[model samples]
Target: MPYTRPARPPPEEASLQGSELAHEIVDVLVDRQAEDVVLLDMTSLSVFADYFVIATVDNPRQARAVVDAVEAHVLADGRSRPKVEGAADSSWILVDLGEGIFVHVFTEDSRAFYNLEGLWNRAQEVVRVQ
Candidate 1:
């Protein structure tokens, strides 16, 4: 199948109600056994997203699992499904949780090459799951 972007929420849905949602996302990543899971507070750093949940997985299969887990939790939380990218290759899947969160599930090498955390050094690291 060709790469398809997940449905994006309306623009007005930018501000998530509770602050704990990001942590909930972190929990999902941890539960999926994602490695080096890091939640970065990007509110002050970027208007693009309030939080960036970056996770490193061992391979493409693990990446897909992490993405599925995240989408499930976000949906159960009453949030719109995110506009996802990179799922076809499953090397680096980005789950954009419309307002409050943006998740990045990357293969180990891809994560290192992108160095997302390094680029957003201004954002504070809120959660780190082994």
Candidate 2:
């Protein structure tokens, strides 16, 4: 079967209200075979995005694929194109999906080095996909 994008949200609706986009991102990452996906609720702890979705990939190639897939999904949802950081060769890539949602894609070694979950330990753990 041919792949298809999800329907765009209504034009009248201003934007994603809360953690709706974060949850959608969790599904996207999982679909692409991301491992140990963790969704953190940063609403009360941080002034940045309301939530953060972090996942680990196997390699740089997989990292690039995951980032591109996420970009496509976010654009298809009618949200502004995200501001992406880091190169495909980098160990970590950060995607800033506007409206207080940030995504961190990391390789196993990099994930361990950065320790985002520990740094943001105060944030609530919304979901964990093992």
Candidate 3:
């Protein structure tokens, strides 16, 4: 069967469970042993997404596992599937979950270089899973 992407709901029509969904994502990452998981509330800071989840893994294999686990959990929980970008081997991988959720997986060096935390410092830090 041909696959179809879910249409992004309007802001007013956005899922009310965005925060819960974000927590669910964090849970998945923690279960997968992701390091330094950070959740940022971007509701006021950005128009592109409402929440950003960042996590670091030591190697490409761990990165891949974290990505896969997150994807599986989101899908199984009845949320819209994200459009994944970048390969597992890449230093960074982004998963865009429409209706204001984005997941970023990066290597330690890549995380430092990009410094998403610093860039989004204005966004309130909701959770930091160490």
Q: What does candidate 1's lDDT look like per residue over 11-94, in tens digits?
A: 545345424778888888899999899988887878678888898988988888888888888888777787888855668999
Predicted model with the maximum TM-score: 3
Off by over 4 Å in 1: 1-18
Give me the displacement of residue 88 in model 3, in angstroms.
2.1
What C-alpha lDDT, on a 0 to 100 scale, does residue 129 get in candidate 3? 89
Please provide, for model 2 over 1-130, each residue's C-alpha lDDT reduced to its tens digit, 9 standing for 90 to 100.
Answer: 9999767556334235547778999999999999999999987888766889999999988989999999999899887799999997988999998767899999999999999999999999999999
Candidate 2: 10-residue stretch with minimal lDDT: 9-18
CA shift of 21, model 2, Å:
0.6
lDDT of each: 0.82, 0.89, 0.88
**Per-prediction TM-score, please?**
0.83, 0.86, 0.87
RMSD of 1: 6.3
Q: List the residue pairs that clash in candidate 1.
A: none
Looking at model 1, which ten-residue stretch has the lowest summed lDDT? 10-19
lDDT of 3 by residue, 1-130 (tens): 9999778666555645788888889989989999999999999878788999999999888988899988898788776687899886888999887758999999999999999999999999999989
Judged by whole-model lDDT over C-alpha atoms, candidate 2 comes out at: 0.89
Q: How many residue pairs clash in each candidate?
A: 0, 1, 0
